[model samples]
Target: MNRVDLLTRSDALARPASIAVDDVSVTYPNGFTAVRDASFELGPGTICALVGVNGSGKSTIFKAIMGFVTPSAGQVRLCGLPVDKAVSQNIVAYVPQSEDVDWNFPVLVEDVVMMGRYGHMNLFRIPSRKDRRKVDEALERVNMSAYRTRQIGELSGGQKKRVFLARALAQEGRIILLDEPFTGIDVTTESAIIDLLRELRDAGHLILVSTHNLGSVPDFCDQVVLLNRTVLAAGPTATTFTQENLERTFGGVLRNFELSGHALHEDDDARSLNVITDDERPLVFYGVKKGKKKPARDKAK
Candidate 1:
């Protein structure tokens, strides 16, 4: 892994986690059940990889954790409280899949990151010195300080991903959730993100990231959760992410490399790729081009 010497949030590092999904089941409005009675415990200072095939409820679970979708059964808790409560406390940060973002909306890098501090501010209050400091620190952490003034629409796929990560950092959240963060990034950006995630983990943050890169689990994540509507297996990477569990989770479609421990091969199945490229999910051009304003509700999702 590449070395990433980045800014640290001591306050965020000192927090504890009670982020757990207890027998959670989510059924959409159309009577489609995405997740079924899934349960897992995520502790502080640990990076847990959420692995599954497409439409396997990974995103649904993330939404439940972020209080976007109310679970039909069971609940998601953070710091021993409900998700909304934890969010009100500004202790949770969520970075949605890049495919869900509308990048054409004109905005500066720093301005975009500053949106993370909205929960911390009172109504109509302007950004304070501390908020600016946090934004600066966050940009530096993601190695995007040089592009702080650049237009959000002018960034590469990898750079856009990094900007969103910087926003999460500026939030100073203890429990961070990322949905398919590596879907459309270059190798260098991927390495940098992995390094930054490790730095955050060592600094006492809890990270739950959904990814298709099984090879990276053993190397960076302390825990792995395999899901296919339910929790097939979840625990330490060494024990829970075995070939047997992967096959069970993927329904025997996962090909295992003999020499690569815990590394599942990506078969020709396009569904397994589950990749959304820039072309597939193009940015929408709307609204008057501007620098920044209070981000809209559900903007992160």
Candidate 2:
């Protein structure tokens, strides 16, 4: 190869990748189109949210990224590599929703987390000392060390979620995809999970979380990709997550409320209150009159 060509290739490799989907389209054999012209890109040191309603092709997009299903058009790339190559190299780790797992399966919690190490194991799939240590550290990080020997089916809903997260940690993948991680967990557990995700993001791990909980999106995610068969919006949360964009994405699915003046039981400062919710959690904004102040967001959701 010429010197110029070699230099160009080296420069590309030197740059860290941001997961990317370029004009991806996924059509099923049944003549149903799952995703269309959808695209988004976010690099490491970011926690992004993939927000959309059920049947909006979230799962299909995820399948495409994981190489479970190939997109009829376009492609998915992770860490500067194709999806298949990334998966094979264990550059990606997935924590599936509870519904996708068979909780009744006869497996201990530690054993389940240890499965994450299979990619790093030898052909025999036996756990080495390093693998065992990774599993133990993962469990401890998720505060599930005491439940390591317990059956997978015997834990609480939140605890089960933590175990899966532990498995992802053990895998030590740079890209983590979590599907509805907060669906059934309590507030405290959800907070803990978000904390862990933030730590991962600060450590240069890329995280993509698919969730319907709009209230929590702004808390941790700085970037967002709104999907509905195709991408409605993809950018920083501050701009892309506005009420107008969300209304376009959710349609009639969100409940919006606006209260002003006497309705708020206030002394009539003309400040208004706005609430947008999907019933799970709501985003609330308190208004300000004149130029005295800008609107303030309450984090109750």
Task: Write down the TM-score of every candidate.
Answer: 0.81, 0.90
Q: Best by TM-score, which number?
A: 2
- Evaluate model 1: give its TM-score: 0.81
Question: What are the lDDT scores of the predictions, listed in order?
Answer: 0.77, 0.85
Model 2 root mean square deviation, Cα atoms: 6.6
Q: lDDT: which candidate is best?
A: 2
RMSD of each: 12.8, 6.6
Per-residue accuracy of model 2 over 1-301 as CA lDDT, tens digit each: 3222322332244445369999999999998999999988899789999999899999998899899989999989888799988898787889999998999999999999999999999899999887898888888888999999999999999999999999998887778899999998898999999998897777677899999988888899989999999999999887777766777998887888878888885585777777878777887666663333332446654
Question: What total of clashing residue pairs does each candidate reach?
Answer: 0, 0
Candidate 2 has a TM-score of: 0.90
Candidate 1 C-alpha lDDT tens digits along 134-168: 88888888999999999998999999999999999
